[model samples]
Target: MRILSAPLLPLLVTFIPPHVTRAQTTSVVLPFRRTFSLSVSASPIILSLPAQNEPYWLSVALCGAILPYPRFFVSNESDVTLPGPGGVQGSQTGEELNLDEGLITYRAQMSSGGALAIWPSSGAGANWTIDVAAIQDDFPTHRRLSQLPLLGDTSATRALIFSPPFFTRETQEPIFPNYTFQDAIPSVPPIPSSAEPNTTLLLFPTANANATVWLTNSACALTSKLGGVMTTTATRTVYRDSSGWRRQWFVDGLSASTNYTAYVIENNAQVSGPSYLRTKSDSFPCPLAHSIPYCPEVSYAVPLPAPPGSATSYTDDNIPQDIKA
Candidate 1:
């Protein structure tokens, strides 16, 4: 009889009876798929405003795009004060004036109409031109929206026509920061995780709404002291992958030989079915260790599904065979 070398003990361990570990756990996770129904409407335009001393308001329409607070300017017009109390540095709404560029901005409560009202100091009129432009996506941080390309038509020859003051008589409305309007509610559900310890999975939601994921030991139920939860309060970037926009999150430090149930919530409403996964027993060794500290001697067998009609149990003969002895 031949005795295996001490160096080869770990290698020989691979050929030992396969039942030394727990039964195999199946990971029947399905990928999450979601598509957005976007309706692109013809872009609307608002022309130039009349440079006048009287309070002048204009109603600019946004064709389905999220309109941010707008900024107004007086081309070649200076030494003119905006409407409101004397010595006010900016506009009536307390917005600062871009004097270098002859621009005045309004950070008031406004709606989709983008109702913009402005009044110059008495006798400040004629030849002077009023240029009104608004930002899209409600992303005020992106100053580029006030510059070229994204700034749309800024040329004097192509200035948009603003509706005459009181022509629409629009009122100040509430402001929606970073608001988005979709044709329909999206149904991006939480995907199931693999049946492995320390598993991380990707989650996707239909809208950029406040989202959360809840994990529980009980299927379809949230039991205190036996569950975990995570939430996304602020807006996050949605990655475009083969399965559309998705976000990844890790579930680590989970106990081996455990069952986990996960679900999704959008804006405080449950939006997905209970996803389930079972972890392998701690006694079972992972096919591949993430890292090895010592000289690696063991060459584990490649894991494969059991043959059709084969018993779930693995024995010395039917276990996955190693590529090398």
Candidate 2:
């Protein structure tokens, strides 16, 4: 089965501070305010089932935190009633949502099968609210607290993190051939003239094969002579195990408007080809503070076409006996 997910919300507000104050002296006082707010919004929880229908459940990771524990409520806008811990109704009565450690997930079952899910409206605002009086004791004695600043409403910022509704892993069928014997190397993109010192190189490998990938200005020269002039400032490596495929390199503090290249070797053997990439230049005026540096535009290599005559090897098994003879 194929599962696709996308980030439901782009921005997520985590903490909400209430207003508080402390008097330092007869004439002096300090005021404390909430820097951020916590909001939760999710796409309708969905569960798609096969022909043989069976009861299924929807599970989502909950993200938010509060100093004093706050009650959480899950409203089932649908006609069905959701079962909760201790057989409680869909909504829990008090401030039960506490975001201390990291991420928390919640699960709810559907009475009927066939792709059950929830559709929370975008910018619907915070689904849950907290009681300021209940958490007053946990407030800092020295520091003051106040209502969180409102850049936007709570619902406007809360977003789904892990399982976005727009993610898809369907691999595109290769229009070209595969390099069975040849080494598949890494390639980098060009750097713009206005780049930052902390540039990120995104490397996308074809197969989930256990290979050694590196960033070097030297190796790239083998394919393109211009790559040789570039220098290798950093290196990173990733191993493809049973879990999944991923890029292992993240280079920071790089020079601006500089040319760079990346190399990929399968099992220590240098691949026949390498990729060339460059960093953007830093000619534009800096944003915020003049001394603060900005990031540059990054470029990445496109997937190369497979070598010719490789089709026979892959389709050899499907060929007819008469045709093969």
Top candidate on TM-score is 2
What is candidate 2's TM-score against the reference? 0.21
Model 1, runs deviating above 4 Å: 1-240, 287-325
Q: How far does residue 229 in candidate 2 sit from its true spot (Å)?
A: 31
lDDT scores of the candidates, listed in order: 0.25, 0.24
The TM-score between candidate 1 and the true structure equals 0.19
TM-scores for all candidates: the values are: 0.19, 0.21
Residue 19 of model 2 has an lDDT of: 20
Q: Please give the lDDT score for candidate 1.
A: 0.25
Cα deviation in Å at residue 243, candidate 1? 2.0
Off by over 4 Å in 2: 1-57, 60-62, 73-102, 112-244, 253-325
Number of the top-ranking candidate, with lDDT as the measure? 1
